[model samples]
Target: MTVNSISFPHPVLGNGDDISDGSISPEISFQISDESIRVDVTSLQTGHPDFDRMIEAGEAVWHLRVQCPRTYMREDFFESGSNKTFHLEGVDFEGLVTIEVSLVTTTTLATYRPQGLHEDYGEEKFRLGRGEVVGIGPRYQFLIDKIYDPLKAPVSSIIRIEEGEDSEGPFTVALDTDLIMIHLSKSDYKEYAGITDRVPTVIHSALVLPVLADAIRQIEDYAESTLWAARLKYLLDIRDIDTEKPLQAAQEILFSPIARTFREVNMRLDKGDD
Candidate 1:
């Protein structure tokens, strides 16, 4: 989850109505090269009397939390100074990486009166235990899209058609990789490929729909298995697609490909076209 979405019990620097000076901003930059990611916190301004005093007296410290939840990776770093570098293994990350920064108490606070806290916050009298987060900064998100060969891109990019073994089944979906591989019987593959150019929508309804339906199911159990799975999961989350009903989710993802297929067929027939 992003830092802004979290609800803190006490006043925070970046959130509403806290810190008189309004300057608890941290700037973070990520430099990714191959399998290494270098995180640099260039500037952090703790511009307030209480925060300054806490830092000077060693009562608080800066906490940086980095997470790549899709890959189930998380790392935390604490430092007294604002500027710091974190060397991370980038290969373990996929989809999205989140960075959360906070000002945490190093020692227990019997009574803390942060300036400029709104009166709604019960006159700002509060007590916090050691390591409690007194202030938070903005959340940062970076998308780590996995590189793929152009031919191996997902159905969102391309679908690979190959002749199937045994020449029995109508079609089978090999949806494990980013590329959706549709294996059809030898004869069926030839005919299917020849006709696909004429009825693209119908081909999508007949083939792509099932692949996507299966993809939805795969994402539930194996979203982190491959780059495509993680990418699909990210799409589903961002589009608010409900994965409980795989067929419906697939239809939504493809914009009702089945319905559009029929519409295209009927239009062609009406115009006396193939």
Candidate 2:
């Protein structure tokens, strides 16, 4: 999420307050190259005397969090200075990466009041619990470029789900030059693809899993040359899935949907949802 989306409990430095006004000034910069992302915090100054006092007393500390949700990667750094690098050797970061800096309370603070606590807050002091953010910097974003356009990539991309004719079977596979199309019978498509679109796992478990499993088996023989298979193989190779075991690889890549189904059901049951 962006910096503006975050709701801070109190006035934080660097939002709009100037450095000369005794606010925080974190001079942060970053670079990405050759399978590594480096972030530098050249200067971290808590200009306000109250914030400075907390830092000196070890009640607060700096936290730098980096996230690459596309690659399922998140790392947190507690260093108060420069030179932080995150290695991304085997991770495939196909989209956005974000970095956030926050000053968090290390210990619970009673009746804490910063130097310039605004009267508009309706209180001069606040009881801040441990781990609460005392100050926050801008949330930075960087886009990672991809060789293939995401909208045309296979499976959910070029290989897509379609509604089949009334006379067609419940699930049908059509392998084309640029697509691996899975057609669900008209009624089933309406139910799963249309009405239940928000929860895609239902469709993936029932339809995509079998189709992907079959595609994996045919990769070396019938489907290898197809664009769908090429993309599928790339996905498996990047995640280090063993294609020799087709069913296992498909399940692994799809995040073991059968198990996920049971877990979801149990969660709903626990919540007493109908």
**Candidate of highest TM-score:** 1
Error of 2 at 255 (Å): 44
**Local distance difference test values of all predictions, in order:** 0.75, 0.65
Worst 10 residues of 2 by lDDT: 145-154
Against the true structure, candidate 2 has what lDDT? 0.65
lDDT over C-alpha atoms for residue 10 of model 1: 77
Model 2 steric clash pairs: none
Q: Candidate 2's error at 204, in angstroms? A: 36
Q: Please give the distance, in angstroms, between residue 189's alpha carbon in candidate 1 and its true position after superposition.
A: 7.6
- Candidate 1: what lDDT? 0.75
Clashes of each: 0, 0
